[model samples]
Target: MKQQTKHSDARRPLMAADQSGQGARQDEDASKRSWGSEQLAAFEDRLRHLRLTPSQQSLASVVLDNPQQVAMSTIHALAGELGVNESTISRFTAALDLSGYAELRSVCRALANRYSGMLWRFMRADHGAEADSESGANRSQGDGKDLAGKNGTSGQRERRDILAAQDSSSIAASFARIDGVLWDEVVTRLGHAEHIAVIGLRQSQAVAAMFAYLLGLVRSQVSELSAGGARYLDALRDLGPHDCLFAIATQPCSKDTVNVAQWAKSHGVPVIALTDEVLGPLAELADQVLIAGTESDSVLSSMTAPVSMVQALANDVAAVDAAGTRAHLERQEALLKSFGAYADKDL
Candidate 1:
């Protein structure tokens, strides 16, 4: 007869097995760190127990959001938009353990390329199905009046019609959702803000400028931070508790724009972000997030949705401040009339 082993003794082998499994996991993790040496080093050196200093994090998120087009020119513009000094931008880079803005950009570009390829593949797959269906329909239509021909033709036509209707309905539904998500929030937030600071970079700067101009008509203290050079930072420094920032960032985001948002948040300022998707880091920092749809026929970002949202917000703000806005508008109209800025047709 063999001696009986205690339950605890029997469990010893199982416990040892578990420990071995944990050891393997640790080894695998070590291997991964070794494989991604630069990334791991950067992460450990810069991001370990990393604090974003608010402004720096905001700016970095913006740049990370729009990986494809981030550049020094964009960064400089973003710094102006956020009302932060250029040194803040450099600090943001160092915080990421990047050599500077350029290296950060190179990393973003690589990421962008990877995403672009994936997007193209998805697009191709979508179109491929449509092509196959269309070809099948044509073949059915080409056949004469045999039983198969009649049945196939009718079936194909009905299917095609159904698909067309489905496409139309899908597009309409998407647009409606976009309108609700983006424009409605913008209007609501603008109404709540005592003062609005508009921030945008690169192509979005125009949008920011336009929003500020229109908000001025409502007698709102609307500042366009995009054009003030270092003065932008001075202006931001002066904002009181009642002020809110409306940051416009699309994919890919400008690093400067993100930094500014971080800065504003750290200072206890509220931010309303208009961007492409909720996944963007800027959206994470925003008190209110507005996601605008970017799917369009063009390769460039579709600004139409965001522009419409801004316009709607401006209109709502004006309506809310009706009396003051009307007076301000009248003054502006009088000035324009005196300058003969209207069309000659009116004259």
Candidate 2:
């Protein structure tokens, strides 16, 4: 079995933003946390357990809601946005036992990467050597024991456990990153849009088409943007303020989809993005972004989290107008029956 390397220590600090005297005027902590302990997941765990005053919690809320801003913005800019004094910001970091705002910002920067699709590079264990050794029948039930040691279960069982763990963790992480307010706003936009377009390309098309189909069952104007050549652009070109573009994009993200999303945003159309990254291109263009984790134990990325998000979004849209959705579904059911869409027999 191959050993996995711990690469957290090697992670480079994100480029620091320009600082000004107006940012913060406090001294650094004497017992500040080491940069090594500043890994994102651990930092988030600390955030969970750390007791906070009401003011600190409020400041934390602003950070939680806009991690990227905290990562990229100067302390002065952040203080201004939150309408809090620079000292209050310093106090908030102090409560977290951070050295100062600089350390806090570094953790935020790492977190932004984690919420985006890039964390797999940092989180996933090295499996390349194992992939080579385990080829064909030479691989026995020893792989799990390889990971869990000699006393552990067979390789097959261990593999199952690893995969299951990855799936569960990915799903939990996906839900954890969701901002309820953003979700509400997205659902509201979808409910009110005169036309809703779901655009996806390549691997993303499956989830996009599924979402569009589910949405169409309850709404009058929902479409999965066709890949039928230039006509896709024609469909996007027609969008306006009354319309919404619900884009489903995953890694290896489509340029066309990003362009269309940006184009719609410029045209006053609300764009809702269900994607894998927090700082992904689509997220940047989207008015509302819902993160869905794509990490997997295997080389190929998982769509489980993304699909679950879509299902939740569909249910929310249905809830927005329960009576109207019920009527529309009933009408569609009647039409399907009239057309004999389903066979009379089970066959």
Candidate 3:
């Protein structure tokens, strides 16, 4: 919410990694946005809404898909890679209404940062005062509401509403990409696999653990890679053609997940990737790719949509082999009840 540093006033058409200067850093933060909007939307959403010429479309594809690479590349390198003149690349930025290629690089760098687990995890918000002032101004325009009169509860409720709306939107957009047939296939493979190994490291591990637990309830031989006492590779010792490896990764995809997934693929293990981008490293290694939107308003991207999708997948897996799943559930319930795991079994 800090005031966007004014680098250029004129904007037109289409637009490199200069990571050194303080001015460059400020521009990067301010320029973090989809071409069509003031703030960033999901990359896919932005692509879908934009009206791009064939040449521009091709260029945008390269830029958007490889933000990390582009963030580090100079305009000359990018233009050469795409068989376009450097001037043409600058024109492409103009088409997107950017001031120039420099602003474009800033945008891509900011975007790439969100996908970086390290950067996203550690970056702190430094715009609290600016953000509140803007919010109050917007409210004034909407209903002439005085900020001083608004209670703390109103602010809290507004924040909650924003979070809920973002989550709901994210879920809807992600689910739209996967069709019924694909989902059915996912359920069948997971349900009938001889073994299931789910691997997620870092923050992604939280979702992976929950997914593994849900899968365990519906079937046997469901093991979580890297979640328990055993190291992930050690757990993979017995994994092979008969088993499946489900790996969850996000932007600036984790190398560990990608490497493990690659190993699984080489050993004939089917890899299902739950990731934000189809072209992401983990998705490249996956035999089955499940795309999920992870865009968020804050430094941390939301996992709510991906977590919801996995939950639904678990439910479908449970229903795939109804009789077998029911028997498993009954046995598990009896075992837990026998151990008095429930405080009130009847309830």
The candidate that wins on TM-score is 3
Give me candidate 3's TM-score against the actual structure. Answer: 0.64
lDDT tens readout by residue for model 1, 61-95: 34433343343234555566557887897787776
Model 2 per-residue lDDT tens digits across residues 195-273: 9999988778999999999999987789889767688788887888999998888875788899888888888998888
TM-score of each: 0.52, 0.60, 0.64
Each model's backbone clash number? 14, 2, 9
lDDT per model vs. reference = 0.58, 0.67, 0.68
Candidate 2 CA-lDDT value = 0.67
Q: Model 3 off-target regions past 4 Å?
A: 1-125, 128-152, 227-230, 345-347
On TM-score, the stronger of 1 and 3 is 3
- What lDDT does candidate 1 reach at residue 176? 57
- TM-score computed on alpha carbons, candidate 1: 0.52
